[model samples]
Target: MENKGNSESTTTTTTTTSTAPSTESIGVAKDGCNSSRILNINVGIMGHVDSGKTSLAKVLSTSLSTAALDKSPASQERGITLDLGFSSFNVDVASHPLLSQRSEIANHYDRVQFTLVDCPGHASLIRTIIGGSQIIDMMFLVIDINKGIQTQTAEIDQIPQESRQSKIDTMSTKLRKVLEKTCFSQSPMVSVSANPGVVSEEANVNNNQQQQQQQPLQPSQPIGLNQMIDELCKFIEIPKRDDQGTFLFEFDHCFQIKGQGSVLTGTVLKGSIEINQTVQIPQLNLEKKIKSMQMFHKPVKKVVQGDRAGICVTQLDSKLLERGLLCTPKTVPLLNGAIISIEKVRFYKNLVKTNSHFHVTIGHTTTTAIVTFFGNKILDQSTPTTKEETGSIHQFNEKIEYSFMEYLEPTSLEYPVGSQFALIKFDHPVLCPLESVIIGSKLDVALDTSGCRIAFHGSLLQGIDASNRQILHDTLRIFKTKVKEGAVERVHSEDTLIGKNLFSKQTDLSSFIGNYLFGILLVSLSPLDYYLNLLLKRVDKKTFL
Candidate 1:
């Protein structure tokens, strides 16, 4: 009986223990994690007329329609990207070895990921260039293989340089003010029994000296963010070396509807935007919600960097949003007046076209300004040109010029225009700083050694497409001469160029594109890449003229 009772008691105890959950038990867990963090980076392509800015972007973006089949008849007929187009392409972070590491991807993801913003190269759309530039992460800085650097190129490059420098200066000033206060408070102190003022002065000087000695020689080190910014700002002529997080792009077109509300179209330069995300109109300080987005007439849940999508906004009218007005995120940094350093600025036609004043096109808007020589004295107010004048003052009706250049995003503010840079201040606040530039002819300014070399080589190999073997053959010849050292040859061996088959020599392309398409075809029969590859192969097989 005792043995039977023990067995029953043990079984009951075991059952109770198994049935009851432990106090430490958390719950069933999930394997995968979802992230709210997003990288929004904007890229812009600027080049002189017929430089293939549109062609380059068309091939890069996954969303935008190609030039041959684009909906607007004007775009197809004119062979130009009318207005502005926005598009997004996915970049695999793992494919790039540098970005594969956890720490690097976490830190330098924006620089590595590619998103392109396409802008019109015509001189008339300077306003659009400025406005569009505000949201970009880096610039492609495209030059037509044929046209080395033109007047438009100088103007385009100048705007971003000026805008970036201005922002750095503004941030630096703020930081310096903060540092001055901290430095004053942190200085060593001395107390004297008699003659307090005398002792204080002497002590203060000594304390300052001691403090200076204790401080690091490199001011680049941050006592705090403000102090670092202040030190950074002191380099008035240089571009700050810093990385910007988040993506933004500015739109050039705005239209209103009776029932549909306000709509705008352009590329997003920096950060991703979601439906219902509050968007700010910087020019007017008005905010609106992103009601809906349409990319190639299809709806998407969210739009991020490099996306060319049309946004329908709530609670805003077309009248409030104009051509030059900035369409940006509600919470982004406000870029304003810039004191920019410029490098290359040219004349409208030739270097000596005194009578020909050039129009500066930034973003989708254009402004008329007088062309003045680089070294000429800038008049404080608007002045008229003369027949025999060497330099002329060009003024716009509104203060749009200044604002466009200074409103560049913080990441890409490089040095000024000339080797001996010039400092220029815009008349008003530009909503988009990155896109603003000083417009002049391409021949006026002297090119830097590196820039000259690039120009010379590019000039030699104009009209050479990457797909053409003849172009590659010519490029190989130029490469041999320009790159004197044997080092370039080794680098060239590893260098991979994009192929015409869309199957660029990249492993990712072969794997993701080729293999993935094959797998999908087993189930679906037709995929975009499969058809594209088939078409490219057929084109390659054909005989040329």
Candidate 2:
């Protein structure tokens, strides 16, 4: 895991090891000088299992001279990325003397650093993949060129339709159908074989180090690897970060590094944390002081927003601080928001109903959230500046609400995310960013049903307590009373008038019928006594005659 840095060019290293690859060589190389600042953008590689996302990430890292970050023991054993892996490389196309004179490249593409995030592609590890995707600026979807797209691309409708002539009509061209309601809906894609024969010499393989092991792979050049890198560098736009907001950091991995004590490695999500600064671990409910900090493997006084770095902290067990933990300033209070209201929710199919459950991914963490409310939500619509973003205390306007008739029913599938919003309530409290909620449904449910699997995605505007539901109901009633009072009054008056007229027109005929029926069927009055007298009289008369 050795990486070298130079004043002129960036260098990367690669090898098979137990430790994660350190991107020490990527920083100063990006700027080509000590004074300039390099822009760092996070990119994630995502696709179905065995789509070669890990290999592609390694190839990109090798091309850039930074060590590839794929050192999971289980992943090495299984030959697949089972967890989130990170690799970074500098791409300063304009830094080269030949391109520096060009206005376009110098103005925009100069000194850009990319943190390549390689996420696991297994369907079972979808949550991990989601966790990876949440942090990245954009996604690079990898698909097997030979296989085209796999089953997870779309829920192939086995139910025969009039449009399809055969029972097994799987059009690979229609794989794009799954994109409409996904977080990666409009993402860029690359196609390669699961075991692409072209493995660059620099791009080392896991090797046949286990049972039935084979010889190490020959150092062959990747076919489309360079072209992919060029396109990525050109396509990926710089992401805006909160350097002035709350001092927040989302650590994906934390472990003891022998002499380093406890090292937490992750990209800085917002604001800045200086050396010796104490940061609060929301999940642990404790504040720990930063003993030391390093960015790009170099010691720094402070780590600013959007930079990837590792920090050694005091008074904390590294094992306990894994992915999904947030380190923020003690001044910022952790929000207890279980009920999140979402807007701009885009669903693939079917109207999202209240009380329905869907998977929610927020900042490299995934969980289930129940649909608490749905409808056209009216919010303040005011964007938050950096100063107001930290430990945000949202004072929602009392008039703001999901108007009555906001529910999305089966009959109203026309309304989508932006047109209508949803209020999702998670099972437990979540620390979601200002706007980072992604919602999607599992495809298994649609296997027997008709339509797409993705449900909806939206950001958390604000949260509400379940206890406030009665107040909302009362407000809705008041609004309805004011808006449609005349219509309601007319219907009530008409109903009362009709009831009075019907009762007045009818007469009582029960007494006469009861008297008549009693004379005929009374056993003690006529039928039983007449039969007994007739039997005795007939027998006596016959004998007398």
Candidate 3:
């Protein structure tokens, strides 16, 4: 009788436990784990122009009507990526070693979507490259192993072979170190033929069959598309997402959708946006509510960090929106007049001057800013607690770790310092981890390196907000009030900050000297005033008498 009772009790307990909900179902839905998390990464393919940028991106096109190069009719004839191209493909997680041991899809085979950014390698389109870099996680520096180095701006044959080769080697070393310091320990470098001919999947299969019939192939031979894909996955690291933070989405493409108003798509760099939620375009100062949202071209309830999503917004026209803008949550405010620090790559030729002007590219938004001499400290130096407590302030070209402050209004305060490197493209800043530079310019000419059409990359140190206390408070003061349509349209223009002394390319020393000399001339000529001289003479005669 005792054994029977024990068995019956145990069976009942087991049944109750099996019926209980699993902890894994916390954020998941009845359908599946799609809503729990997204597996997507943004990758940038960078190199000199004509280094097979668009061709490489096309190699990874997701579909037939892909977002590849030659979007412009002119570029089609030229065979170069004129502006910028974006394409994505699904990569099986089974191909790369999974870094996370506790991934939800460990047991099941999962696919990770990679969004490829194809930047124009031409110097003329460096601005576009800078904008694209702001939203990518990693980069593939493509170089032609057969050709020395070629870009539209560079004439490699004109320069001495040995000298050019040595300089290229030096610049490359510096870029690789910067990439390792900023992006990850490994910077993926791929060497290809001068002109890599494209082969279709069908062709590849037939070639494989023929090869098998002909002879046995060596395992180490690197003569296929699989080898290229493997190199990309070899050292790629997944960046952590901030789902709990305020929602921020960088919009690179916007188009009109039939029956759905305007549809905007880009990578979600932070937080989450759901249908019916209100979002703000901080740059445009436009407030909008999310009418509908789609992920992977299907309607989804929400779009989380790292997922490439398209949002259909109501009460707004498609004509008003463009690239280099963002959708942020209405609850959290965007950055205004923040003082960020920067660390340039080791071989970055142009040294920054105080109040020196730079074109900053932060997450696709480009703006002009001036550099200030904050103090001499390494990496990100902390501000002093009190007036007497003098802490270190870093400047440009200082210590391997130096602290310099950059005062730019309307900057994104999402990323942590040293986490993303900033790329300067013809006075534009792009987001980063450090990497190499390959230039075909002459080494002897101490050319004003600033104007050179080359991608200059550096680490962005954590910035201290030097916003006008009164202005910041005033901004919040207005936010506390009820917001209506077109309420906060002038935030950026209101506090736009070019420092007081930023007359660039050359100093205002001549002007200052001229002004001083004019003052002296006025003082000397004032004593010669006829009436004033007579009065002074009379006073002097009276004193002498």
> What lDDT score belongs to each candidate, Candidate 1 first?
0.37, 0.51, 0.45
Give all TM-scores, in the order shown. 0.36, 0.64, 0.54
What are the per-residue Cα lDDT tens digits for candidate 2 across 238-282? 577667867777778887877657888887877888888778777
TM-score of decoy 1: 0.36
Q: Write the per-residue lDDT of candidate 3 for residues 433-527, one digit (tens) a residue.
A: 11212111112333334344332333343321334435433432111222112111121222221123223556544654322100011134443
Best by lDDT: 2
Q: Candidate 1: give its CA RMSD in angstroms.
A: 33.5
Q: By TM-score, who's the top model here?
A: 2
Q: For model 1, how does the per-residue alpha-carbon lDDT over 1-545 read when each residue is reduced to its tens digit?
A: 00000000010000000011111121111112133232434555655545445544443444442221133688779766554555544333344333344463445443222345666666654445555565554444444222234544322111121243343344334333433543222221111010001111122357456421222121111111122112211211212222244445466567776788887766655557778777777667777778888654566667655555678886686876645433454443333222222333211222223223333334444333332222222333332222133142232211222222211111111321111111222233334344234332222234331221100000001111224434433432111112111111111112221233433355353334322111111223456455544544444433221
Candidate 1 vs candidate 3: which has greater lDDT? 3
Name the regions of candidate 2 deviating beyond 4 angstroms: 1-36, 62-69, 95-110, 152-219, 330-347, 377-397, 404-419, 438-453, 465-545
Clash count list over all predictions: 60, 4, 20
Arrange candidates by TM-score, highest first: which order?
2, 3, 1
What does candidate 2 score on TM?
Answer: 0.64
Q: Once superposed on the true structure, which residue ranges of model 1 sit more than 4 Å away at CA?
A: 1-38, 46-53, 65-70, 95-98, 101-103, 106-113, 121-135, 139-249, 255-260, 266-311, 315-322, 326-365, 369-545
For model 1, where is the 10-residue window of minimal lDDT?
1-10
